[model samples]
Target: MVKGKATLALELPLPEEGTANTKQERAYQAIREAILNGLLQAEDRLPSTRALAQRWGVARGTLESVYERLQLEGYILRQVGSGSRVSAVMPDSYLKAVIDFGVTSTPIGEVPTSNPTESVRSETVHRAQVGMPFVARLANPQLMSPAEWAAHLQRAMARMTPDQMCNAEPQGALALRQQIARYLRNHRGIACQAEHLLITNGIRHAIDLVARVVLQPGDHVVVEDPGYPAVHRIFAEAGASLVYAPIDEQGLDLSSVPEAVHCRLAYVTPAHQSPLGVIMSATRRLELLDWAQRQGGWIIEDDYDSEFNYHRAPLPALKAIDSVQRVVYCGSFNQALFSNLRLGYLMAPPQLHNQILALWHTVGRSVGVSEQLGLAAYMHGPAFLRHLRRARQEYLTLRDIVLDTLQKHAAGRYRISGEHAGFHLILWLTADQDQDLLIEAAAEVGIRLQPLRGYCQQNQLEPAFVLGFAALTRAQAKTASLKLAYLLQA
Candidate 1:
């Protein structure tokens, strides 16, 4: 009955202005916009008939008519004790659709999701519609334009011949590995060959494979303090000690790299640093490679969004710059194609390839061989690069919309970073700000964004969040920005 107890959400997704003919419909749109815009969110008890009527400067009956309209649209549910509570969002079928498109033919539950770090959000909720928006990986897995890739996908399916179905190559389809290698060499400037590439069931498998190969229990690993925490969790489960280092404006500050570096593995998003969005300078990249090579350490390069740079083409991947062969390069089709695709790869030097592949065989358990063939076909056929071109444009447009909206809406309370590439961005709250409390406040009104606090290391730095823009339409981004701004203003 009171806003005191409930989850915060964005103001509801509203119908557009002037789209509905009746006053009730118009009022419904208004209230819906408020909810979608985060002006009104879940469990925030609505004003009574008289209060709503007075606030809108409308007759009581007219307000009644509007509330009734919202109820009919399933925007709110009324109960005896709880006068009117915002309705949970209607689940979109994109997640299910992607699942059906043949990634993990054996349902996810059957496989146990390989990685233990998958939370309620990763498993149960596929598309992040309105709750605690995570910025590291995109929430909307179906973010790729299927219609655009329809031709490429068709080529892939055709390539999935019965011969491909009969056998499972532990190293993945040879053709696919070759395709990936060519793509990397041509696009990222990384020198890879089919011999070094191992395909697995997405990033989880790739990360797990890396963990199994490089890290021993209790081994120390250097992790960026404000980098993706989900990753740190994986390394921990693998029994590694995560040594935290703060990320600065110029990418992660390695100024403090210990002379006696103890970690066996170090993870960095050097191309466009996660959360911070700054590109690592070529000089720093050389130093980092040198440090790892000298220490006999392995660098886990999560080239998450190296393919989606905005201001310029992405920097050469660390793997490309390395003569030392210390970089274990990993990436996925999750960002470019879809999340549930479960298609990611790890490429290591020939020296470490067997161990990495053995880890892949041990942990991956099963691979989506058919999808790999399809992806290989897509990559080689005329459609792959073409699809990427269109995707880049759409993704960039959405990013611009996000920037414009944040600039227009979150004027005083927020500062955005890491905007040049990737699916998400980071917003650093003012020094005096309380992100935890502010996140709760945001929920009360209906806008859900991840607070940066969860991503930080023990008692370090100010709070910030990683947020994705690829999943939202430009219009929705604008509305979300406005909603977020309202919360900040409050």
Candidate 2:
């Protein structure tokens, strides 16, 4: 008899009477199960509490309890005059954003945390959540519930030996590089032999290694404005002068890039651009390649979300399009796979493999043999692809759930940006309202979010957030969404 039940269900025969005292509880359970199972669509109206009670033969008071629980769970919406509706959000994206928060180099004490699990989750704790996740860009692999990835890691580790860790982890650990290579081939269209690949800590380290070999102080590099801050920051730290290009729907506006930042480097997220979530069109991809070749600038193609592309099979990474050795295409399993393992590689100019290996030797020092070995074993083994496929499916489910639920409950008031692909979603802030108040209210409701303000370049800009989904369970995602929708009303 919960008031939040969806109106468009198949109308199964009502449950038998007397099994539960409070028919409202029974109603809530049924409706919640229906929503979780995707039996209802977004914007689907719900029967009033009275109507639901009549259907279940429960008193309206009992029905009220059911509605309260649904609201708490973020599975339903309630209004003074409006009826309750479904909650929406991208759970998998939120999970990844939580994990990535840890990958970047941040001041240690700056991250707030009392709970170890959350401490492990945010790169910085007390990190806010909401429509502003792009600004936060916090992705936490550690936050991924171990219970979920255990079976996959277990299968991969079953084959490992103690001696493996004792030995020096190779250029690309036989198992992991191979596993990674295979995935890149199948998913992102990265073509390379396992031997040619050099596994490193994460994409940042990989980028750093490349920076070491290819970039020198005063080097001019073109980057996207409002692009991945990590990329620009790293290059800037390495003494590279950057020409920041404004990004439009077509991707990075090369014209906006000053001629001065025209050294051999440019970083681009082609599948879905970071923060803004714009995919690079084919024409723009070729134009970028042409620009790189003509200017002799090295194009660092970041294959961040090509794996989870919702629009179509992912575009072949920009490296695949290179006839010249201009594309230093880099990607990592960190985003697609869980963290706790630093497994990512770069597909470089064929001649630069040895130089890249040499650079890793001097710069990063070493990566874990154990993680590399385990991930490799998974990659080579049948289960590796299976795990990816499973995650891929679940990520889509999480994305759809978030998008559908938000559209259902909030409608035109709150708008969602980004694509159906990727582990995270970006919600644009149309107004500069009291974002802090909104976030605080969300916490009061027991749902959490990271605001986009943290990801902003400076105070002069508006706010946004990079909500992740890889860690959150479907149930958790649904509950989080309902709480978020209520907050949106404020």
Candidate 1 lDDT by residue in tens digits, 1-490: 1344332221233345555545555555566555543455555667666665555555778767666645533456667765677763411221232233322211111111232233212311123442233332463434456665666556667657687777677788998999999888767767678877888777766877888877766566778866776687788788776766777655566667665546677899887776677776533555566566545677888888777877655556778646566788888887677666778888886667898777666654566666777688778876677766777887788778767776776677878777777777877787777777777876676556676565665436567766776776667766666777676666
lDDT of 2 at 380: 64
- Report residue 258 deviation for candidate 2 (angstroms): 2.9
Question: Where's the lowest-lDDT run of ten residues in candidate 1?
Answer: 104-113
In model 2, what is the error at residue 69, expressed in angstroms?
A: 43
Query: Which prediction has the highest TM-score against the true structure?
Result: 1
Give the CA lDDT, 0 to 100, for residue 110 in model 1. Answer: 13
- Tell me the lDDT of candidate 1: 0.66
List the global CA lDDT of all models. 0.66, 0.61
Q: Which candidate number would show the highest lDDT if scored against the true structure?
A: 1
Worst 10 residues of 2 by lDDT: 104-113
Runs in model 2 lying further than 4 Å from the true structure: 1-170, 430-437, 446-453, 456-464
